[model samples]
Target: MALGGCANAWAAASSASLPFDDIAGSFAKNEIVELVEEGVVNGTGNRKFEPKKNVTRAEFVAMADRLLKLAPVDADMPSFADVPAKSWYYGWIEAAVQLGIAEGKSKSSFEPSARITRQEAAVLIVRALKVDPGSDTGSGLDYKDKSQIAPWAAPYVQAAHTLGLMGGADGKFRPVDAMTREETAAVLDRILHDNVWSKAIRQTPNMGLQLGWQNGLTTAQFKEQVKNSAVNTLVPRWFFLEYGSTPVSNHADPSLSSWAKQNNKKVWAMLGNHSDSALTHQILSDGHARAAVIQKLAGYAKTYGLSGINVDFENVNPEDRLSLTAFISEFGTSLRAAGAVLSIDVSPDLGTDWTEAFDYEALGRYADYVVLMGYDEHWDGDPVAGSVSSLPWVQSALNRMLSVVPAKKTILALPFYTRDWTLQSGGASSEELTLIQQGYRIRSVAYNRSWDSDLGQYVVSYMRQGSQHKIWVEDGRSLGLKTMMAAKRGVAGYAYWYVGAETDEIWTSLSNAIRYASY
Candidate 1:
């Protein structure tokens, strides 16, 4: 039988005897046992892992094939002088080549039996993950032998290290040293467990925002208020894509970015269409215009030293759905190259024309986090009276969104403000009021406020100026419940619509909810 065929046969049989004899007290014992059971690795014979034994290129290729579950490609194998066509490992090596996970040592020779070096392993892993090591300008390598690393492998080594797939020993990355079986197992384990495909996917708690531009709060004031809160990421509306395909700067405050950095918080520069549907459609439909906008936004993010960019394109036409996705994909590539996150704010999928323009799955694939605007269940202009974002309604929206978006890349955006509906003869009009303002209005009117468990908020109804007024208050209790729900669902995090609109108790509630959810 061919070597690759024999390897698989051995793997199938070796599952009966896990925990190789020689690996009992080894540091990599658990991982070796696990990989052996996972059929990604098999003992050399005599039921031993030989953890210290050097791994060959052919062996590593077979292991990678098993781990990645690579499908057989229906094509003629590339001719390698050293790798015979009839060899068992030949099929896996060819599969690796087809997957772009491995390459030949020379034009005509794969040197399949040669020991795999650390650098070669790094390059293979990086290629397997499809990581784009753009420019390699972030941080200098801490390895003592970094200079000895091959020029071609430097980026791969850096990327592998950044992804937590590989690390150095004694401050030295023995680039040319042969990788051991244990090391290979450990690296594969890290890839399976710890490696984040994208830096934008936060593994920790991420409480973010969409800073209300009209608040006019200085950086100092904003920092002082939220210094003790759970807020860790700030998205200030700093730029707007104007008509005529122009990128206009809004509140370009550098202090906000600096303060956020000083506090170990991330600042994402927000770019919006300013609710202009025509302008959004015009920019998205034209490829050149869209590219220009993306370029400008990427440049602005780099210039302002921002950690990321938040896309808040609203009221987009359904015709521009694919165009919007294309724009985000390109923009994300550029931003990711610059080590920046790309978050997109999408309205709740309520079967509306405006919300239908967003392709949740497509956007989730390209953008780091898809921020669900969980509010506006009933907007200011809507004739019906209802909660802005009721529990049932938000839960339904979340379920639909998660059907396409990964929970790890989803951010639940909640409303910190409520709408005060004024019922007049013509129609009902509402004013957006902060949580504190809603509280004051409720108190000043002497309205009887009661909690509606169905809506998960306090509802108030009163008469004023010959018109029946109503307020569905979104305070600590309501926001906390939503926050806990998001945490329970294992979303990336939650974001409040506006920063200054929230009450002090709202932060406490969020922090408590996060604590209770234990995510």
Candidate 2:
């Protein structure tokens, strides 16, 4: 039978054996046993893996050819003038040539009968996988006769040498020596196990060392794998507005701390609207008030191991603009110096000089992040069927701010809580009832916008009078669209003003949208 056909037939019928299976016996039985047990070599027919027979050069070619599973090209066998279509090893020779594992001794001439040397086998095995034959430093492996290897094969020989697979018998590489069947099988098996072919086998490292073991990964690869798996940024936002006179009894709660420390989450201790007039005045009058706040912030950061801080002070006087600026500049410098993140909520005023109550430009320069408070355009005081912040109005405000502030530092704030208004006979009035008291109905919330020709801006639609129906504001769907707009604008990220007041559905939807969002 042809060698290639025999190899294939043998391979098709072989059964896998455990690595530790017993094989000691007669030479023929041992050859078959070891070959079958190691799954390195195979043979033809009934449970036979021809053990003691001297492997022919063509047979070696056929065995190595099976590793690649390459298709034979449609061509005549030209390895040797003696080789013919009827030759027993024709198919194997064709496959070896196709895989570049074996080459002609001369053009159209393969020395099929020549004994394959160990050096020749090494070169062929490395070449089959396109392994780089590196420079001849003669430095790595102290193989005594390394200088005898031909310059063309230096790299391949060096790689095999470094891999500890090429120390020759009798303590010498014996570069020019021919190989025995046993030597060939050992080297070929090692090469196969190392090259990526035996991925499944090598993945089973020291069985107990399950902490880190993967296909073809060295210690460096293993360390890098762990590091890469751990790579993530923690970006928690502390609802600064929420912290107040209410004592936080849950500070020791693991769930709260866990949530804060999770990747892309953090705590922001709310420097809320100071009900204490003394503290409020302290922020305005004392030049060192900023420093005091910075000290307080540093303490907070260290205490909570916080990722950052967010300032949510509301109703500060117009006169405090410069104080606010100085405070922010110093506070930002302190936080950044301490390697903490800082974000601030700001009044959404488009006009630069129109409102000096809060300096947007100065705040932008000092804060790492600035959230545009884009709600409350119409409130309990103003009875109008209009959006809290219309698209055009938001766009206009954004354009004006972009003129002064860097785009990346901005986070478009989407209001989680919507305002409800009562439609009266003559006009509309803001509903005094809290959102939860309204029976949790969300469809009543109309996300409406219309172009106002006179104002030349899109106006939000809300109930203004009788029969127009009270307007319930934004929900997740509307907020998601706004978040997309923020992402498209390349803002740092979207921020929901107050996550507490938001329903589970709203949180789920918005969180889902921005869960993997990149800044």
Worst 10 residues of 2 by lDDT: 204-213
Cα error of candidate 2 at position 81, Å = 83
lDDT of every predicted structure (CA atoms) = 0.77, 0.54
Q: Give a tens-digit lDDT track for model 1, residues 157-251.
A: 99988888899999998999999999999987666565442221223344434233224567777676567556778777778888753556566
Candidate closest to the true structure, highest lDDT? 1
Q: List where candidate 2 sits over 4 angstroms from the true fold.
A: 1-255, 262-264, 275-282, 350-355, 432-439, 442-468, 503-519
Clashes of 1: 4
Model 1's lDDT to the true fold?
Answer: 0.77
Give one digit per residue, the lDDT tens place, for model 2 in 1-519: 599999876655443342221222332334444444555466445544333445567767766654443333222213346566677777567555533456767655677878776566667767765567766555664667877877666677777776666666566887777765555656656655555555633342211100111223342443343333211222233322113342111222234435436533344544554433344445555675456557766666666766566676666666677877777788788887777877777767844432455688888888987877666666557757555655556666766777777878886765645555655666776653322433243324443543233332322344433344444435433454455455556676555444334443443334322321221
* Residue 458 local lDDT, model 1: 65
